[model samples]
Target: MDQLPTVQPHSPIMAVLTEIEYESGMEPSFGSIHDFCLELQELFTSSGWFFYVFSLKGVTKDGITGLYRDGSRWTKSKMPFPDIVYNRIHSRRSESSQIFIDFVEKMNEASIPVFNRRFLNKWEVHQWLNSRKNLQRFLPESCVYSRNSLQRMAASHEVLFLKPVNGSRGRDIMRIQSQDSTCDVSLSSRNGIESLNTCQKEDLPAILKRYLKKQLYLLQQGLPLLKMDNRSVDFRILCNRSSKYDWRVTSTVARLSAQGHFAANLAAGGDTIHPLRVLRHFFGEAQSTSKLDMIRELALEAANCTADSSEELFGELGIDVGVDDNGHPWIIEVNSKPSKNDHIGKSSCRPSAKAILEYAQILLSETNPPEKGGSR
Candidate 1:
């Protein structure tokens, strides 16, 4: 496996932002996540504290020295040690899986605050975030799968979206619709749309079989979201918990999908607009502003609700909010690390990165207080 180059050790103040290096065995490149870590590092550095990023992958000085290896023994490095280990490892399989897990365990044992705390597992987080009672106002009818449940969902709704339970970036998403006794299916992709029409009663069994062979997925009733210029639109609400444990809205933007596309994801070629403008156009001057206010309230409520339920020390969240024809807001999804695409400091918005860094400082203060001679 290839390795990441390392930076030279600076003073202790500069070393406060070390990262827990993830081995290259992980599937997705850590570029985006790494950028986030760097953002946090910069934020901490400006706050009079040092930040250092440490990865288990051997630490190399400008791609020369390899301090660690796959089968080699671990050793203390000359680099400044970390006061906290942010567990961003996403590896599902590895030869050193046990070793990495142990490292995280040691960090926890040492009282270094971990972002997720490992208490709220992924499934638990999803269930809590998507619960009907908790987020009913902002969610569509969604149920974890079984063949019978999917068939029932198909029978009731004209169209439904089937998604992977652990999916992201709109991958492996399919739309199913009923047409008399026949059912139509469309697979979503960046390349183009591929679809098939089949009998609902007779074809469901085979379709379910094919879907089950892949992985676990969820069946969701399709929401009738308002559209702009024949394209569906959704809002990305960025929320973060300050050091004071108060949830604050960092930013919100309207993502409008291109014509003929169902997803409004940026990766899917969607364009972004101001939410205030989109809502005003969709609802008209008199009623649109009121609706926007309501959407903001609901977004903040959902963020607080999720933060209250989870035990993790999360400082930020990216929530996808959809507005129905009734001018009501519904949550589409909650992202742990919301992208900085339309971040504040950009065009008309506040810098979300700055807010996130400030929040992290607060969290760190709460978790790791300064010594008697030091400042928090």
Candidate 2:
């Protein structure tokens, strides 16, 4: 596995690995990504790091073959193997492929850092968190999707959520409410929950089978989430590893569910506001500050637990926590590749971009130190 030593680049390169966009007729596109590459390039220009976009095809090649912006157009060329790989691949299916696995293994053997190497599904994450007792309080009862499991959960909890293991943007999420003799099923679309159907306990399985077919789902105990204006509220806490490789809360915001909706995802037309603002509206100003601190602590704990649960390196994580009527935080979900940067910079360097570059530099130095007169 050893090759002749070659001089490392003076300016470290970071390839933002992304999937290709097929519908981008003439213009080059990466995984529905538009201006991300240009913005990152512009942001890192004044720094010692270099950022370029790499396609999934590059992963199977000999060296890192990537594309970069020349002017207004994109140019394809072979790039110096990245000092660090920041995976931005948006497709869960692509990430699960054998090629992606092999690529990550190769990088690991070479001591090349690839942060957020594998996308973690809901079931896998649940199992990981279940390994630690201290973190169990923040987790809801979750199990792999099955008709019997769904019915069993429904029997115990008055409310349950049937979620696709790999579903995103709140699509195909079903909420079930059990009554005396009828079970109600509510389906969430791209926007939010738009329709509901009620059925008997025996009829519920037939309906779900017709809707879900053979697709996998996870059954979760639902929470009576805090609501404002008849719409539920949840918190998205973005945690990033600092230059020192320590977990820190990058930002936290409260998402208000769309009108007549149950899902609070931004892609589902939900609105985001400062968490402190929402807390103040409920709790006193002084209490709001303390409550925010508590949420941050909980988020940090979840972040650490996630990193410790997996063998893969994680540079950042997006932890979604649902606050019940009692203001208790429960782990709703964790996103490995969270892209919502509501707190992005307007004039200065973008915080998320800066954090990524700083973490990359740390990995490069940690993996292989530089010589006396040069950097690794």
Could you tell me the lDDT of residue 52 within candidate 2? 67
Candidate 1 residues lying further than 4 Å off, grouped into runs, are 1-30, 33-41, 54-78, 85-100, 116-126, 129-134, 344-350, 368-376
- How close is every model to the real structure, measured as TM-score? 0.77, 0.87
Prediction RMSDs, each to the true structure: 6.9, 4.3
CA lDDT, candidate 1, residue 361: 55
lDDT of 2 by residue, 13-52 (tens): 6678887553446866764345556667776545655556
Over the stretch 190-288, how does candidate 1's per-residue lDDT look in tens digits? 854567446556677677566543667778889889898888899998887765667778778899876667778777777888898898886888987
Candidate 1 vs. true structure, TM-score: 0.77
Backbone clash pairs for candidate 2 read none
Candidate 1, run of 10 with poorest lDDT: 63-72
Best of the candidates, TM-score: 2
